[model samples]
Target: MQKGKIGVSSDNLFPIIKKFLYSDHDIFLREIVSNAVDATQKLKTLAARGETAVSVENAKVSVSFDAEAKTITVSDNGIGMTAEEVEKYINQIAFSGANEFLDKYKDDANAIIGHFGLGFYSSFMVSHEVEVVTKSYKEGSTAVRWTCDGSPEYTLEEAERAGNGTDIIMHVNEESEEFLDKARLGEILNKYCKFLPIPVVFGKKTEWKEGKEVETEEDNQLNDVAPAWTKKPVDLKDEDYSSFYRQLYPMGEDPLFNIHLNVDYPFELTGILYFPKLKNTIEVQKNKIQLYCNQVFVTDSVEGIVPDFLTLLHGVIDSPDIPLNVSRSYLQSDSNVKKISSHITKKVADRLSQLFKENREEFEKKWDDLKIFIEYGMLSEEKFEEKAKSFFLFKTTDGKYFTLEEYEKLIADSQTDKDNNLIYLYTSNEEEQFTFIQEAKNKGYDVLVMDDVLSTHLINKFEQQYNNKRFVRIDSDVVNNLIRKEDESEHLTVAEREELSPVFQSVCPADNGVNYVVDFKSMGENGQPMVITRNEFMRRMKDMSKLQGGGGMNFYGDLPESLNLVVNTDHPLVKKVLAEKEAALSADLETVNAALAMLKAEQESLEKAKEGKKEEEVAAADNEKLEELQKNISNLEGEKRGKLEAFGKDNKLAKQMVDLALLANGLLKGADLDKFVRRSVELIN
Candidate 1:
């Protein structure tokens, strides 16, 4: 027997291990089990190379817990350390045996998992004392038992063992007693070691007998020694991949498609990525991709390992190249991580491109569900954007899907404006903007359904990518103005427009956070009598603000919505309203206009007489007369506007037209909608 303090530069090493070695105390089980797996794999590697006579078959790692004893033990059957090897590796705190093993067996040690020797110390986090009983595979080697409390001091001595292996026994501390529970220990094992390369046993398999679960003789293996990702892609079928996905996420829906990633030249990376049916919201669908180093689970937050948008995908990504101690800042700067990120982005884009090229009809069927993810990727990753352009689809309001290039060709001849810019018409809501979409379709223009949360940002990216291309919402303007082929003239004169503007403006909802600007356009008698449209730029900005939801963008979000109330002058209803207004207020306006003309003439004459004159040179009486003339002119104008507004308020047809436009835009609600219904019935009657 021998006793000594652990070799270390600092006396605070054990305290650091106990308090801050790992973020969670439950991680101790993973560290211990992973070490056991490494030991077991090392034996297999040595046996394969004919370096050892030890049999590698039926080798396994088992985790058992004693509730009353408040202890957890992880045992394995593999290459273990002799007494001298234990003194060197165990006495030294940071010395890693896996690293030295890899240096010796660099070519054949692919399955070795441990990179940091401190993994053994992690057991001290949850234990008041930890004991290791190991027997090396060397012929006539003596078994040894190593013991250490939650301190630098430890004991090593010869012990008895059945075979070559190691057993880690942890006496649970007061605060870490939860690990003594079998169920809790099983959960931790399932989370971190469920896909380990070695079979991991927890306890006896259970059977439902005598109306209760009874432990059977069969060992209850907690892990699948070989997961789908560890096998060659050729060996996996659709069902096999789906079964693996179910194992990863028990309650998740089946994925739309999958990309089996196998890269070895640049850096060893093998895993399966599945494109899940993402919800319209991006945040809720993130952090589903689990990352691993070799077969040991690292994290589910893979934002840095893959691009931010790729976080939307669900799957396993195993790479020994990615260090086990993951930090966001470290991942961002690591060269290997950058390469892996680029590779994943390329893989996703390539898979999508293949799906589109091979079976476009099937791809189109899934476009609506796959759109948000693709759009988010294009908006976030530039390299992905370059590749995604080949597979990105534009879905029309009529449910037809087309690639960007194909749609560009389809609309190049018809949708190009007079400025030689290609106009891509789109609608966020097909039902609410049905009138606008139909009008566009009537003119042989196709409208896309850009309704995803990322659509606004994506369109902005597209606009930046192609200066000659523009994305215009179908309801952003009248059909004639949406893709202008030539200059157009207003059908109503200035005087006529002035008379009609007030009539439409009077009925526009004032309390709603919406500002309506009345404008007249020539759409022929066949066009709708009224149409509501929003400014594309402003609306897109507000949409982006809502999606991003913070910072200076809140300004745009808080601003009231502004829409164009386009009244078709050629429509018979609008013509009738103009005629009716003329009959009702023309006489009253004329009387007021005559009085305003005389007052304005006197005022202009007085202003001409005082031209370039000093204030002192102008007569006091002349100034007083000018002031009186201005007051009378102002009063007459007010009187004229009052009569026009009064006539507008009394005009039911004008109010009904405004309400119809509001209703079509989904803005009219509550009492206004009810009023529109009642007024609509009366008008029909």
Candidate 2:
């Protein structure tokens, strides 16, 4: 027996390994099992090269634990380390400038483990003592045993073994005794080694015999040695990709499609990415994309390794170029990782473009499910945005799909405004905004359905990306004004508009958090009598504020909703309401208006006298006289408005028109809706 301390400058290495080498102590199994796999694979390579005569046909890694004894062992049938190799690889920590490395990475546990080749030592994280019984495949080589008790000190001695392989036996510490549980060990193995190239055995296969589970003689392999992603894309069928998806997500809905990634040059990368069916909401399950290094599971939090938007995809990504132990910050800065991310984004875009080109009808069927993902990618990744334009679809209200370029061309002649701006009309809800959508359709305009949670942000991004293009919600303005080709002629004169404004405003619902402005537009005799529309910019800001939840946007959210009660002047009902108001309140309004006119004339003359004069230059009596004239004019105008509003309240047709607009907007609810319904029944009776 030969005993010696591990050749390291610091005596505190063991404690550091046990306490800070890994964030999660459970990763010890992954490290040890991974090492076993490397050894087994190396032996296979040597045998294939005719460097060794040993057969590697039965090569496998097995994990077993003795709960009573509190020991877990990982054994492998492969090229094991000789005593000299053990001295060089295990006894002597291979990291140069050890003190500096330790100091630089003491706070970053993951960086410490992989950066300094401390994978084998991770076993100390869960073990108070660990033993390695290895036999080299070299002819006439002696088997050796290595023992360490969570310290730098270790014992190397000759040991008996039946085969040329290695066994890592860990005496789990008290805190990590949970590893001794069979289920726990099995879970760890399944998570970290489920797709290893080499078969991994956890225990014996079981069967339900004699009304109870009985262990069979067959080894229960925990992994698929050759998963779907490891094979060539041409060799895989659609069902094969689906089956792999089920293996990754047992309960998830089947994905829309998949992109097989197999790149060897610049960087080694292989994996399958599935476009999962997503909900309209952005509150999705991210971190579903499992990342691996040579099939050894590294992490599921692949936010930086892939573009942020791509994290919504589910499946596996195995890249030897990505180090096993890495921080998100390191991944963000790594040049190779950047290259891999760019390649993945391009591949995804190309795959989508191909799918759209090959079967556009089928692509349209999947557009509702794929819109959020494609839009999110376009908003987040600039390169992806450039590629996505070829496949990103604009789904219209009538269930037609068109690419950005296609849709732009289709609407160029019809929807372009006099300002040379192309207008893209859209609706958030097909049912709620049905009236607005129909009005747009009546004029031969195509309205898109932009209902995803990210739609507002995406629309903002689109406006910034394309010149002379605007995305307007169909209900944002009256149809005639939405894509105005020229200045529209008003049907009512200034005095007529002023007299009718108070009448329409009087019946507008005084709902909390709602403000209504009466507006008039000539929409011809066939148009609806009244329409309620929201301002596009203000509404979008509020929508974004609700989605993003903070910052200056909150100001928009907190403001009352401003809606335009657009009264179509050409409609017969509005014409009747105006005529009725003129007859009922004409005398009272005339008396008030005559007094208001005289007071306004006096006030305007006084205001004109002081137009170029500073405050002190104006006489005190003149300023007082102007203030008195302004008060009298305001009072008389209020009196005139009061008379008009009184007549408006008595006009049932006016109230009915306002209610119809509210009902169409889906804003009439509870008592207000009940009132409207009751009034309609009374009028009909």
Candidate 3:
């Protein structure tokens, strides 16, 4: 026997391993099983080169628990270490510079283990003592044993003969006796080593024997040695890819389609990416891409490796290039990750393009379910945005699908505005915006169904991508104004327009934060008395702000909602209103307007001299003179508005007109809606 001290520079290493080396003590099993896998893979490489004579086939890794000995051992048949290799690898604790490295990587230990080669020391986390009994594959080799007891000193000695492999025996600590439990060890093995190259045998298979469960003689292989991702693209059928998906996610629904990535150029990458039926855009999740190094699962949190948008996809991404230690902090740079991202994006777009070309009707049928993904791709990834427009689809309110070019051709002559801008009218809620859709349809215009969460951002992106083109919500304005063929002259004068606004404003429901704008449009004198529409720009901005991580829900959201209330002077309701006003208060409005005009001139005259004046000099003259004019104007306008509001409150025509508009837009709710319906019956009667 040979006894010597550990060759680590720091004596506090074992204590560090016990306390801080691994965040979770349970990961010690992963380190052990991974080391066994490495040794096995190296043996295969050696056998392929004809360097060793021992039979390499049927080599397996076994994790067994012995309750009597209170030890769990990882045994492998591979190129085991000789006495010298054991002394070098086991004696020298190749720890990362903890004092400096730990501070930099306090948040994540990804680089720590991979950079410092601390795979072996992870055993110390759960073991009170660890022993490595190994024999080299070289001919006529003697077996050796190296032992350490959570300390700097260790013993190396000649041991009893064993096969050409390593046996790592960990004496389970009192605090961590969970490792000695067969069920617990099996779980860790299944989690970390389910797809390792070599067969991992934990225990005998079980079966029902004479109406009781019993262990079978057959050895259970706990891994699929060749996962589907490891297979060549031409070698696999569609069924094979799908079966593998079920293997990875046992209960998930069948995928829509998949992309087989086999890239060896710029950087080594291989994997299968699946497009799942992601119904809700808000429910789209990240880390669905399971990243693997060789056949071993590295992590599922592949946020940095794939683009933020592509994380919505589900499948396996096997790449030797992706480096992750025990703690998985993604460390790839923007370039390598960008390459992977661009590659995946291109592959997905190409696959969709291929599918569309192969079967047009089938593609169209799936567009409703797949639209959100394509739209998100177009909006979030610029490269995809450029490539996707050709294959991207637009589904009209009538349920017909069209590509950008196809849709443009379909609506080019009819929906084009006066400036020749292609106006794409769309409705969020087809049922709620039924009036707007009917009006659009009546004018021989097509309205698209843009109702998804991604639609708000996507239309904005589309407008930017297609210059001289704009997307307008179907209910954003009155039908005539929405397409805006040519601006029709308003029948009412400016003074008459201002006069009617206060009347409708009084009857409109103020809660739900609604505010109104009164505008005049000549609707051939027969249109509805009032029509309400949302401001498209602000509405879209608010929608997009929610999608792109609503920073403060209060900011843009707190402002009172705006609606356009259009009045047709030729309509009977407004005509009746005008006659009533002429009989009641037109003379009063003229008097108030004249007084306000005089007061505004006096106020403007007073503030003009104070433009460049100092504060004291400005205050020296007529500050109150300007204030008096403002107060007097405010009083006159208030009086005029009050009289109009009182008239609007008393007038059934005004309330019915605004309520009819609100009902058309589906904005009137609860008691107000019922009252509107009740009032409609009374008006008819």
All candidates' TM-scores?
0.95, 0.93, 0.87
Local accuracy by lDDT, each model: 0.87, 0.85, 0.80
Model 2: lDDT equals 0.85
Clashes of each: 0, 0, 0
lDDT of 3 by residue, 1-685 (tens): 9988988778887788778766566778877777787677667666766667888887888888898899988899977988988876667666433223346434432212233457778888888899999998999899999999978888999997558999999998888887788788777777767877788988889999899989989887789988888889999999999998898788889988899999988887889999888784656465577877766666677777887778888998877566554343344565776777788888888889899999989888888778888887777788887888878888888889889899989989998998889899999999998878988898899999989888887777778778989999987887888877885665777777778878877887877777787777766565667777789988987776676566764466656678888777668778898789778997887788888888888888778877888878777448878877777888888899899999999998889888888888778899999998898899899
Over 69-88, each residue of candidate 1 has an lDDT whose tens digit, in order, gives 88889999999989999988
Task: Sort by lDDT, best first.
Answer: 1, 2, 3
The most accurate candidate by TM-score is 1
Candidate 2 residue-wise lDDT, 496-605, digit = tens: 88988989999998855699999899988999999999999999999999988958799998888999999999999999998887788778877888888888888888
**Candidate 1 whole-model C-alpha lDDT, 0 to 1:** 0.87
What C-alpha lDDT, on a 0 to 100 scale, does residue 436 get in candidate 1? 86
TM-score of 1: 0.95
